[model samples]
Target: MLKVTPNPPVTEPASITDPTSPYECPDSKKFNEAAERALDYYLGPPTARIMAAPYCPNRLYMTNPKSSNESLLVDASETLGSANVMLNDFAALLEGTHRKTLLGIAQIVMLGELAVNQVLDNLVPTE
Candidate 1:
């Protein structure tokens, strides 16, 4: 008896954007718009996804003495810039730093748990 192999599904490039072709969405041009939104969310304003429109820098930008007291889980403070900048500076410090005195470590852990739950929920939804 011969085993039958299933054919690979074909994706319509006409409906998809070619990575090299620069935002060409054959659909309704919505994909292009969405791609730009995603990029802007990461690279443009409200970078933390927590700030309002004006995007004024928050207290997190200020020096936290806790930084001196305890080692951060991701200690890249020596190399400061946007990438290392926390999701919401204080937000991560509250959650990631091993510093016992810092606020919101519990909250950060809760949020992380919720995010993980969301992923798992997507994979195994209740019937």
Candidate 2:
């Protein structure tokens, strides 16, 4: 009778009975230290990073930090007034619902301007 499969190879058992742990190896300790360094490099410190000041995206038209509150209010009021006038002019050129919508926006801007002016009037000038 012929055999269908080959016989398995016989091998001798190890003379030493104890198996060594990977952590006990000198190369494994170096690998562990390298892994720790990589982790520390990728992940920053435990504490949250603090910013000195808030970041501003636009550098072109930034308000002066030293400008007085009254001056800032006046600038805002003037801008709102100009916007209201432009809206009204544009509204005059249109007809029907579009004109009404533009006029509504203009009225809101005018209200803002009036509120700012009132605040300015109430504000006492600082010497």
Candidate 3:
């Protein structure tokens, strides 16, 4: 049997510091402060407050705030089907290395299709 799926290489954890050696084994307080600062940087809201929208935007965009679950699922299914078909068609047109790359992308699309199909299947009861 041939293995098509890729497997990640196993890795062993590295020691941060040697016990016998000096240098205080790196201060936890400093590490905690750095980690806290990083968390604050990422999680903190925008520092610059935008009080109002642009007076005249080039293009206005709006999304459906009240999309139903069924409608969303149907849309997802249709989009997935279209994407899979387009990807397969696009992949067929490619040659050599590009073909393999596109095929890998198609595999990802197929996985998404599978996931969506599974959700739909579970949500809708069969007669």
Candidate 4:
């Protein structure tokens, strides 16, 4: 006969004995900081079934670009995914009812690029 295992009870304060690991409670800034993880939790992750998350959720792209199917390119896929999805078809989403968490990731990348440019600009100008 096959045996089934029962799940352990969850504890309020996580410790070695607790079934779940301790995690920081949601904070006001968590949305901006952990958008991707939040989206993965909600949208059930972009597995082989879902493909990729939008890289530019803010833009109304006619078509998105494709990235390599690799873990290293997961962040890159988010932006290209946005370009791939038809913006016209998701007018309601564009109106801003749903959170564009994936696009937020792309925006973060843009911000990082700006920072890098500033650093490079400073270095090149210095003799």
TM-score of each: 0.21, 0.56, 0.51, 0.23
Query: Which 10 consecutive positions of candidate 2 have the poorest summed lDDT?
Result: 12-21
Give the lDDT ranking, best first.
2, 3, 1, 4
Instruction: List candidate 4 stretches off by more than 4 Å.
Output: 1-99
lDDT of 4 by residue, 1-127 (tens): 8769878976554434444634344352355458766766677644733455545565574334453334224444454445434432353365453437545555565666555555555545545
lDDT of 1 by residue, 1-127 (tens): 8769878888767446456655455554777788888998888866467655565667876766566322331233223223223334554455445434333444455455555555555655668
> TM-score of model 3 relative to the true fold?
0.51
Q: Show pairs that collide, candidate 2.
A: none
Residue-level lDDT for 11 in candidate 1: 70
Worst 10 residues of 4 by lDDT: 67-76
Candidate numbers, best TM-score first, in rank order: 2, 3, 4, 1
In the order shown, what is each candidate's alpha-carbon RMSD?
Answer: 23.8, 13.7, 23.5, 23.2
How displaced is residue 109 in candidate 1, in Å?
0.3
Worst 10 residues of 3 by lDDT: 48-57
Write one digit per residue (lDDT tens) for candidate 3, span 39-124: 87668664522333445544455336587676777788888888989989998998999999988888898889888878877888
Q: Which stretches of candidate 3 lie over 4 Å from their true place?
A: 1-62
Which pairs clash inside model 1? none
Pick by TM-score: 2 or 3, better one: 2
